[model samples]
Target: MPRKLSRLTLKEQADKALREMISSYRFFPGKWINVERLAKDLGVSRTPVWQAMMDLEKEGLVEHIPKQGIRMAEMTLQMACDLYTVRGLLEGLAGRFAAENISKKTVARLESILKEQQQIVKDQDVVEYSISDFRFHGLIYDFCGNWLLKELLENIKTRSRPFVCDITPIMSGLYQDHVEAVDALKNRDPAKAERVMRRHNLRMRRRIEWTLTREERE
Candidate 1:
């Protein structure tokens, strides 16, 4: 049992290390990550490393090769387009719901989060800005009065973190988009809020595509 527990600990560490690598793009998109090297770096046996790689593969963050080892998953333009379409539909629904069902108190909470995001932007603190940006969206989803929608969005955001982190340098435009979205929500204009939210998501999707294209060409 103790031996089994030790193996579990190794797998857990490997999983966490792989997640950090993916988030940091250390295993950059399309680059094959040698499992042996990874095991050596993590000071673990290949069994734990392989287990972690399988988990990441299931999450769509890694791709396993028949003989070559694992590679970081690349985000294609088409995938981004599809993801944005779904995001727009679901988030637009959330925005419309918030406009109808949200309380003034919730709006005030969103306002506070937006203000915090603005400060993070002004300070050029990219990490904090990204965190606060997610918090702002979360506030809206929570007020949307639908647990299922909220959970769906949360799962999507987890899958989206890599893309979001890649586009962190464009925070200024994102900040403006957030401000407009919140303004529309404050006015209780569901139509306008949904429109703005969709546009904002579409714009970010486009930017991510542009980045991916440029990287591919390079």
Candidate 2:
């Protein structure tokens, strides 16, 4: 629940900061992240930095090699596809629950977010769209009323950052998908909402694959 490092314990604060940096692609995949340098950069002691690294290792975002240093985990194409597949399944469940339980006020708020998403996409504002996308999905995760499911999905999403944060795949098609998914929720159609949300994520995997294929050809 704590978004800011100041709200966490010292070790947790270090973990949160370092996790943000890694997930944001500040440390590229497979690059060695020096604990000492990171501590200096983060203005924290090496102890907390080490502690944070351990936490990240458990999440598979980073790994400690024997006699080497901490390196950002390498994301294979298979891993990326798998991550999106699992995300689609989990978020599909979230969508189903949200459709059954979401309030009218929440539906209105989601529509507003979708409107902002449309404008952001039109403007080609990737950063703003990413934030809006997170908010849109996060609301559904919360409204689903399944705390364990939400936590599990959040962890998987965090693991997904190694791929999602670094890629610049085409996103123009997603705005409409978001629109349709929101419309399903507005109609209180659980089956349609789940199908739409799952399709949205699965299509994202395809876009990512297409981007990779093009890169290979290039």
For model 2, the run of ten residues with the poorest summed lDDT: 1-10
lDDT (10s digit) by residue, model 1, range 19-100: 6555443555678888876787666789998998888788787798886768877777787777777888888888988888
Expressed as tens digits, the lDDT of each residue in 1-218 for candidate 2 is 21333534779889878766754547767889888877776666688889888988988889899999899898877887888999999999989888899999999999999889878878888767876877788889889889998998878877776665422355677887788888888888999889988998888888777766666689
Each prediction's TM-score against the native? 0.72, 0.87
Which runs in model 1 stand beyond 4 Å of their true positions? 1-56, 66-71, 164-169
Which one is best on lDDT?
A: 2
Q: Locate the minimum summed-lDDT window of 10 residues in model 1.
A: 1-10
lDDT, candidate 2, residue 129? 80
Candidate 2 lDDT for residue 186: 84
Each model's lDDT: 0.77, 0.80
Clashes of 2: 0
